[model samples]
Target: MAVTRSLSTLIFDLGNVVITWDPRPALPEQYTGQDAEDLLTRLDFFTRNADHDAGKPFAEWVADLRSSGDAEGADALQHYVDHFDRSLVGLVRGTSQLIDDLKAAGVTLYALTNWSAETFHHAQAAAPALAQFDDILVSGEEGIAKPNPEIYTRALERWDLDVRTTGFLDDSEANIAGAESVGLTTHLFTNAVDARAWARDMTGAAGV
Candidate 1:
């Protein structure tokens, strides 16, 4: 059976859902193309990213990256990180189409992302498409991250939403489970083609 109209909101994960996520988009400028993956294996961007995402102090993380590795190479890497759009992984297939479709159908749209406050605005600027969201909940800004039920709670609770009728779409299973635990319907998003199609069909059926 299709979900009902009681779930009037559609929450989307930003990175893998709307725009793509490449942790080291600028690494090739600092290292050999083949070694980019190797360096990424050794470095933990996401781990270093946690503090920023939670909206805590993050000057230390930046300093560490600036000081690691060969001074020149590290500096080169820092330059890329400072200037290039590392988060511009690419638009997930069909993201624009889906968001546009959702708005046209009168479904409320939101972006629920575990992102750093430091880089979030920069990313939004780089990807002009982010402005489409009706509500944006960034982990850093909210001081909460997903996979944590609290974050999901904030999404519905703060918005006075009916969880059982709301939709949460993310690339992470943990996040999906978290949202589901809070009585929210979730889509375990993988590829954009199927996801966008699902979004269109599901929301249409729900009359949202």
Candidate 2:
């Protein structure tokens, strides 16, 4: 018979889970609608952004774009970087309350996120609730990103968290899968309400 471990710790993913991240809003007004989408696609924005999250400097990425004759894309990326704060629209609705409830219950909280090292400060300033976390492991700082088993392993090891008692929540299915691969209890976060319910049930938090 296997003993079930009570959930006492939670690992959170920042983007889309705790805070919303959308690059479209960071683009120039002229790049609105399909044009913005096109720009991102043409630049392979997601891929490059992932690289940035892995600690590749944005200046180097822009230089690479310029060298590839995508000066327009390069310029656009620079502008987006300059106005990165605009991309962190706001905290996900209900997340603050959920975090507060969990904190009050003495649940251990930590954040694991894939964000550029250069720009993560913007998110810190934007979301006051982030301070509730006992600690945050940033991909850009570690040169590793989610959906990679290594980072999950590192987080668990670094935090001295037990896989059986620690729960991981992420908006991205890929990230959730990564956590699961490492034997963690996982939650696919669609909304704060569902997430809060899951946390409450798992942790048996009082008044949560």
Candidate 3:
């Protein structure tokens, strides 16, 4: 018979998994529908945002846009910075309860997230449940984003966690793959209910 190791520690991904992020609301009212889609395309939003998550300052990005004769894009980016709080829609449904239950059960908890250092405060302010984590590792702060094996290794080393006993929960398939590469048990989170079941099985925590 094979025996399974119980997960004593859990590393959670904040975006989507804990906090819901929707940039649409952050745009000016005029940039609605196709205008919004076009604006994002013009600015290469996702790629540039990834650079921000990897520690590139927003000012630098805005400057680059301005220099490229993209004043509109630059202003929009600034607006996003000024009103970043609006982008954090809310907490993922049922995650706060799960976090509370896990904490009550004495499971060590930590957070690993890909987020801009300049704007992470918005998420912090919006999600009170985030305070439950023992620690949080932000990609922007570390200058290393997810899907990078080094960050996962750093998380393990920083927390003195045994990979075999730690489980990682993330919404990104790439991030989950990275955690698996590091030999940590992983759950690709879709919703809190499924996550609760996985947590219960891994931790044997009652009422998870």
Number of the top lDDT candidate: 3
Q: Residue 75 in model 3: shift from native, Å?
A: 0.3
Clashes of 3: 0
Per-residue lDDT over 1-208 for candidate 1, one digit per residue giving the tens place of the 0 to 100 score: 8634444678999887888767666655656566766665555655666666777645555467566644544554455457557647678877777777677778888888998776677668656667878878899988889888999888887778877567889999988999888888888999877776667665763322
Which residue runs does candidate 1 get wrong by more than 4 Å?
1-6, 64-77, 205-208
Judge candidate 1 at residue 177 and give its lDDT.
Answer: 94
> Which rank order by lDDT, best down to worst?
3, 2, 1
lDDT of 2: 0.92
**Order of candidate numbers by TM-score, starting with the best:** 3, 2, 1
137-175: candidate 3 lDDT, tens digit per residue: 999999999999999999999999999999999999999
Q: lDDT of all the models against the reference?
A: 0.74, 0.92, 0.93
1-208, model 2: which lDDT tens digit per residue?
Answer: 8544579999999999889999999887899989999999998999889999998899998999999998988999999999999998888999888998899999999999999999999988989899999999999999999999999999999999989899999998999998999999988999999999889888998988
Models 1 onward score TM values of: 0.83, 0.96, 0.97
By TM-score, is 1 or 2 better? Answer: 2
Give me the displacement of residue 208 in model 3, in angstroms. 1.1
Q: Residue 167 error for model 2, in Å?
A: 0.3
In candidate 2, which residue ranges exceed 4 Å CA deviation? 1-5
In candidate 1, list every pair of residues with a backbone clash. 7-165
